[model samples]
Target: MPDYQIRTLDDADIAAADALFLGTLHLPPTAAEQLDNLRPSYVPGRALGAFDGDELVGTAMSYPSALAVPGGAVPRMGAVSRIGVRADHTRRGILTALQRRQLSSLVEQGDVIATLRASEATIYGRFGYGVAERVRSITVNPSTAEIRPDLPRVGRTRLIDAAEAETLLPALYEQIGLRRPGMMTRPAGLWGIWRVRETKLDGLARTAVHTNADGVADGFVTYRAVKSGGFRAELRVEDLHGATPTAIRELWRFLIGLDLTAVIKAGSQPLDDPLEWSLVDRRAVGVDGVTDSTWLRLLDVSAALAARSYGDAEPVVIELVDDLLPANTGRYRVGADGARRTEATADLVMGVAALGALYLGDVAPSTLAENGLITWSGEPGQAALGRADRLFRTPTPPYCGTFF
Candidate 1:
């Protein structure tokens, strides 16, 4: 017997585990902040890892988070991130054991979904996790961001200190979280993660905030300029959060207006975000690639949907189909009339993975229907269902600043 088993982590395992992680991924050991945030001090071992005797081979961690089903409320979610296996232990059942235990444990704890950023695109798809969202990196020649000087400005903008983000970020995040599904809740100390990434760039990163008419810091943009080969500038955006469209637009405008930059590279954007459309030369920017940002497991999709506010009108009765988890395979009635809940109903239905795909608007009704993911009664029902179906992202795109 190879003698391999999966179990909860322990603080004593940190040093060895960190070493194992670095070796598995073939990257230089990260700074204290990256490791600390991923494996918190309190839970030094909150995650599960596979071991062979005293040797640590496979590890995975889950962060406390949430998922908002538009038209319903937010449900507590566990984000399974930083999953890795030792290079030497390529096969065997280490990964399977870890993931199986993690998913079951999360479901047992009442998590509506278990999300993660899949490193190996081929790995997680087999674990019943469908592609829920996509992110794209853009390399823009900043010297050419020719933002219209008089671009119809909406809200007052100010350059807020990164330290101030702690107090302001949560409010803005909550507002956006309601409409987006793949968002995660940032705990107190974890608030410093964004700042650390910025500071690591040696002052090249900058942030700009937007305040509403009532004087609220509703949004912020974090970006940095790094050296590029051939003397071209490479700017990467850490994060951008805005409560209202007006604020988001202005923050974007501010970013576009940055001076003396050669290239602006941004990632973690939503697929259909309108930021590219806002540019004078639409084709100037190109999507690097569309990779899944979040994977969802519908532990209780019904409860997830009934807890949030939805579209502007009436109600929708949907039969949700989950091929993996049989529990969520049923009918759910969601309405924006303030009454959101799942009921045993006799009606049409859609697959859980399809809903996950729709979670980011990556999948549309006509396409889902065409693919048999959902049945469209007629043109009217199709239109109503599409409108009633809320997607989780802004026009700028939803990007998790950190890989987690």
Candidate 2:
């Protein structure tokens, strides 16, 4: 028999669950007012708790959102967050149990995928999650940076107050839409949590919006300034989204022109951001580091495979091994036409985690095979690996800039 029981949490159980989660992070309990502000963001029937008799020992929850896959298909995805287990319960199966239960629940609700920003690198792979996207942390010397003379300056940017941000930002974000693979639609529940964190908890963030020549809002950025010393400060960009290249350039131009800021730092920026090319002096931007951002798990393998468009390549049969979701363990034929289950022999074999990494086209099949994450069904050759690589290749590197 198991030592703990897992069940969905109710309104009355939220406080205990929150406290248990906080304890695992070595953080203090949430204050009454902050908790009150955060309570409604929890979607009913989504949060789960593992109970050791009457004690809440583990907690996990997800927000309902849609992920933009390649070829402009938006599929339902569960944005998982706040997963934790009590420190005393280490080495036990409580964390595994919670993950299994949560994944099963998400599958039953018809979610095609699940994703999370991992707090640690080693925790989630066994649960079938894979690092799907990567981001770079960049620091710019604003004083030395200059926008190139040839870059278009078609848009105008203006700062907005917090109250205006609360109303205008969401609408502008929706208008911008998900133009890139791995981006996600922010639902009301997720937005509520961000609002609480920005306004109630931190209260230091600011916003700026960009408008096209016709005076339509097309992009926005949120950031906070921190004093570095001696009257100089560093501006940290929290979030930035743009609908067009011109809008993105204009927004950066506005930020570079801000007063009293010595440097600007932005995290989780896409690998293909044109900021460097737009600058007259490319070395003005310094790359601090690159890190994993979004980790993805394919809940429905067939549906996910068919949703994204593929590059031109001959068909290749891939045999998937899904231990947690046994129904997905089978051979699939993937090509430019689409993907479907096949009875023919597979050319290559991989596990679900490998599939997740390959799904977004961030990592090529050849790279995964070289890393020992994939194997050949027969004798290994470059033909199959090259075909798979071309089939899954994307024009731009996949990036998920949102931090849940």
lDDT per prediction?
A: 0.64, 0.88
Instruction: State which candidate has the highest TM-score.
Output: 2
Tens-digit lDDT track of model 2 for 115-183: 999989999999999999999999999988989988768868988998899788888888999989999
For candidate 1, lDDT tens digit of each residue in 1-404?
26887888887676566667657767655476565543452244347889888778988767677765543345787777657789878788788777778777777777877777777777875566767667777766655555454557776777767567556666666655544544567654355444434444543666677877787777777777676556555667778767665677778777766766676767877665667666677666777877777766556666655454544555667777665566777666655554334665524466766665555444555566777767757666676565544422223333344454
**Candidate 1 residue pairs in backbone clash:** 71-309, 71-310, 72-305, 72-307, 72-308, 73-307, 73-308, 270-397
**Superposed model 1: Cα runs more than 4 Å off:** 31-45, 154-182, 189-203, 212-215, 229-232, 276-288, 305-355, 359-361, 365-403
What TM-score would every model get versus the actual structure? 0.76, 0.96
lDDT of 1 at 42: 22
- Work out candidate 1's RMSD over C-alphas: 5.0
After superposition, which runs of candidate 2 have C-alpha atoms over 4 Å from their true positions? 199-203, 377-381
lDDT of candidate model 2 versus the reference? 0.88
